[model samples]
Target: MLTRIVRMAFQPEKVADFLAIFRDSEDKIRNMPGCRHLELWQDADQPTVYCTHSRWDSAADLDNYRRSALFGQVWPATKALFAAPPLAFSVYPAGVESSLSSLPASQ
Candidate 1:
């Protein structure tokens, strides 16, 4: 599995518009092939900062979504609302099991 994170900083006034776009397209994004999970996170200290965390089956899967028409349309609009360039990164497992099953139980 691959995890992707994108940190977006939007104009304060444009945050609502950005969120509206997300609301309208989230389902389509989540339903994309190889998409396992998708979430939107907001920074408590910086209201204009938002992040999208998603898990994909592989890098190719992520690339497919990026190249899709849905992304082509949504990205341009989203980019226009940004206060700064977005930061994006991807990560894969470190060859260790990090699931809840590997953790000790609570008292």
Candidate 2:
């Protein structure tokens, strides 16, 4: 599995509005090929900061989404709300150490 995390810092006063934009965004990415899941997170210490954690089957899957209209619409809305350049990381999952006899719960 491939994990992609993006960190975004927004203007403090507009944080809620910015988050709303994401909440109301188009469904293009959600229906894209290879997208396993998508999640949104907010920093506990910094309310104006948010992050997106997504799991894709591969890098190519993410690339496909980026080139689609879903990204085209979402990017501009997201960028306009940013206070700083966003940071993104992509990683491959390492082995998990589990003690459960059956399948463990998802992280």
lDDT leader = 1
lDDT per residue (tens digit) for residues 1-107 in model 1 = 99999999999999999999999999999999999999999999999999999999999999999999999989999999999999999998864466655679999
Scanning candidate 2 in windows of ten residues, the lowest lDDT window is 93-102
Q: List the residue pairs that clash in candidate 1.
A: none
The lDDT for every candidate, in the order shown, is 0.96, 0.83
The local distance difference test score of model 1 is: 0.96
Instruction: Mark the regions of model 2 whose C-alpha exceeds 4 Å error after superposition.
Output: 96-107
Off by over 4 Å in 1: 96-107
Question: What's the lDDT for residue 86 in model 1?
Answer: 99
Give one digit per residue, the lDDT tens place, for model 2 in 41-103.
989998888899999999999998889878888888889888999999998855554334347
| Cα deviation of 93, candidate 1, in Å | 1.5
